[model samples]
Target: MDTITTLIERNDDFVENRFPSGLKLVPTLKTLIIGCVDPRVDAAHILGVQLGDAAIIRNVGGRVTPAAIEELVMLRKVTQAGGGDMGAGWDLIVLHHTQCGITRLGAEPALLATYFGVDQQELAGKAINDPHEAVTVDVAALKASSSLAGGFLVSGMVYDVETGRTEVVVAPSLLREETTVG
Candidate 1:
């Protein structure tokens, strides 16, 4: 009846073909991937995670949202139920890509304002919504809001579509050594 249903039905064969063995499924996701809709970047493949191991939130530009944080909060609760829980605090990865249509769209202020229903002047004053900055900012906000143990690890990265390489963008900090050298 809906586009999702239609698409799933049409592709059911493809999905069934992939899961022919009918493996058991479990929810062990302790990580969250916020990535763009670029077809070249597959979050699951890049993160080397199985189907039931991670919760991925993908948007036009992989921007964080209220909904994303809500999902994290719920997941954290589930993972904290017992010792050796697999779903506790989440590792957040904000993956952006080079030569991204979303980035291009982000660079254009007028277009950004037009889509967000605000004017350039308002946007410049932080009154208007910016889709690009919103994504990065949201990830940070989510990290701050999450109350999970170990204080929710958050990192932002840029993926080069051509080379299939990803690099982290770490801000200046006094503590915690950088994990990935960009």
Candidate 2:
């Protein structure tokens, strides 16, 4: 009845009855979603993505760090090399949520630095004053990456943890100025 044991039992049930057999490596939706590690913000549920629908990358604050870029590049390369119907291209969705824990770290610089193994100065780059602004910044970083090939659409979104709703902070077209998500 411990947590791990319960989780293992659930996994057994999943594999027995719910697991999708013979699914390919390529996601059915041909998309990638980068989101926060916050338990309240489940990217799959928020985006309505079923299993094998999209590749999800979760991290603290969901910042587009160097490691995230590397993973994205690898995903692109591998999927293209796989040579299938889903190999055409994939879109990117950067989802940040309101009331993220990173927004609170300003009051605990020491803890942040220790957790990330970096000095206080380095922690400034990870700050999240506003979820909307953070999503915009992360989307821009992903779009600017030369490693990610052209023709991929990137959208920035903010999920409201309180209301259980999500809104577009930056549309994929990137044609209009910022709009308040209401």
Candidate 3:
């Protein structure tokens, strides 16, 4: 009848019918995705990934904050401690969507604070005026983190809610500027 009750009932069918036993901690695709909390932008559905394929981190704006980086580092540590192949390529995808709620909060600091329960100053870096630029900034932040090794691939993409299309804003190879031509 209620939301939780519905989910619990559904989960019963899931566990009984299709839930796999003893899945590995390592992602099958060896990737992690950071995306917005918008319901319209379902990362797994849009990306065509099933469960156990990747680790997903969702936030208000999909911004790569310090806390997100910490979680990533922990993931890496856990994977290594489990004797998983760390040298295998790990892709970090930062996915943002068009018409996100974060953009609406840019003009209303009071509303943003009320929603997130923080002061205005704390929300300074959380604004998303442009999804393209925001994705680039977030990807750069994740790539620059020392915890994430150089072998880790980081990319930025924007999912169009209107058209159900995803555009690559920043490729993993282009995360940094190329200063010279070979």
TM-score of 3: 0.81
Task: Give stretches of model 3 more than 4 Å off.
Answer: 85-88, 108-127, 174-182
TM values, all candidates: 0.58, 0.82, 0.81
**Candidate numbers, best lDDT first, in rank order:** 3, 2, 1
Q: After superposition, how far is residue 123 of candidate 3 from its true place, in Å?
A: 8.4
lDDT, candidate 2, 134-167, per-residue tens: 8887787766666665556688899999999999
* Residues 55-171 of candidate 1: C-alpha lDDT, one tens digit per residue: 677766665545555655565555445333322254666776666665455468886565434576654532124433444554555545534333346777767678877666643
Candidates' C-alpha lDDT: 0.57, 0.77, 0.78
> For residue 166, what is the lDDT in candidate 1?
68
Tell me how far the alpha carbon of residue 21 in candidate 3 is from the true structure, in angstroms, after superposition.
2.4
User: To one decimal, what is the Cα RMSD in angstroms of model 1 from the true structure?
Assistant: 7.5
- Tell me which of candidates 1 and 2 scores higher on lDDT: 2
| Range of the 10 consecutive residues with the lowest summed lDDT in candidate 3 | 173-182
